[model samples]
Target: MKEIPEFQTERLFLRGITLEDTSSYQKHFVDYEVVRYLADHVPWPYPENGIEEFLKEYILPNQAMSLWMWGIFLKEKPTEVIGAIELCRKGKPENRGFWLGRKFWGKGLMTEAVAPITDYAFTKLGFEKLIFANAVGNIGSRRVKEKSGAKLIGTEPAKFVDPKFTEHELWELTKEDWSKP
Candidate 1:
C-alpha cells in the first residue's frame, strides 16, 4: 500500500482523504454547477454510502501506481477540507480531476492544488505524462490546464456521457513539458 504523501505549496497542503471529508464531498458533489460536466458515474447528490465505498474500494487499493485522491486544505487550517483532487492512472499515464467549494472558485486554488500532485505523479510515481479533459464549454478548466503547462490536444465530442448534454475537450502535459518551469 502506498502511504499518504503530504504536498506543500505556499498556502495549501495536499493530503490524503479521510472519513472526515464526507461533508466537503457532500457540499461540492451535490452542487449542480459542479456536477454538470462531471462523468455520468458520479451520482448526483452523491450517496453517503458511496463516499465510504470510494475510499475503501477504489482509493485505498490503487494508491501504489494508480489512483491518488487527495483533500485540499489551507495550511493554517489543516483539518478543514476546502476541496478534493484526484490523479487517476489510465494505463501508465495519470489524469486529473478536482472540485472546490463554490466559494473557492476563481481564486486560483485549483491551479495551486494541481501542480504538486502533477509533480508527485511524475517525479515520485514515475509517470511520464498526465492528461485532463473538460466539457468543451468549460473554459475555466481549460485555462487551469493551460496554466499548468498542458497543451490543448483538440476537442473530442460526446467523449464523456453527461447527464446533461455536453462536449468534452482533452488536454495533455508530459514530464518533459512540466520540468521546463
Candidate 2:
C-alpha cells in the first residue's frame, strides 16, 4: 500500500484519519446540516459506531485499494478535526467527496484543502481524471469544484442520506487541464 502523506495548506493541515478522531468526527459529522447532502451510505442518525466501523472495516482495510481519507484541521488547532475529505479509486460518476463542520462552511477551507489532493490524484496516484458530484442545491460544493477547474459534464440522480434521491450536478477534471497554467 502506498503511504498516505500529510498535507499543509495555507490555513489548514490535512492528515490521515485516526481512530482517536472518532469523537471529533462525531462532534462535527452528526449534525444534520453537515451530512444532509452527503452520500446515502452515511447513516442518517449517524450511529455511535459509525466512525469506528468506517476506520476498521473500510478505510484501514482499503489502503491498498487506493482509498485515501483525511482529517482536516486548522493549523492553529491542529488536534481538532473541523472537516474530512476522501479520494477513492472505487467507483464511477464521482471519486472525491468532503464535508466541513457547519461552523466552517463559508470560509473557503475546503477549497484550500482540495488543491493539493487534486494534484496528488493526478501527479502521484496516476489518475487520468477526477470526478465530483454535488446536490444541485449545494452551491458551496459546486463552487469548490468550479474553483478547482472541474467542468460541468451533466446532471444525474443521486441518493443522499437525508433526502434519499435528488438531482446532482456532475463535474469532471482531467489531469491535462488541471496541470495547465
Most accurate candidate by lDDT: 2
Q: How accurate is candidate 1 locally (lDDT)?
A: 0.76
Residue range 31-111, candidate 1, lDDT tens digits:
777777676667766666886787777777887556788899889988778888888767322277888777778988888
lDDT of 2 by residue, 111-147 (tens): 8888888888898888999888998888999989888
lDDT of 1 at 53: 80
True lDDT of residue 47, candidate 2:
83
Clashes of each: 0, 0
As a TM-score, model 2 comes out at: 0.93
Clashing pairs in 2: none
Q: What TM-score would each prediction reach against the true structure? A: 0.86, 0.93
Question: CA lDDT, every prediction?
Answer: 0.76, 0.84
lDDT of 1 at 96: 77
List pairs with backbone clashes in candidate 1.
none
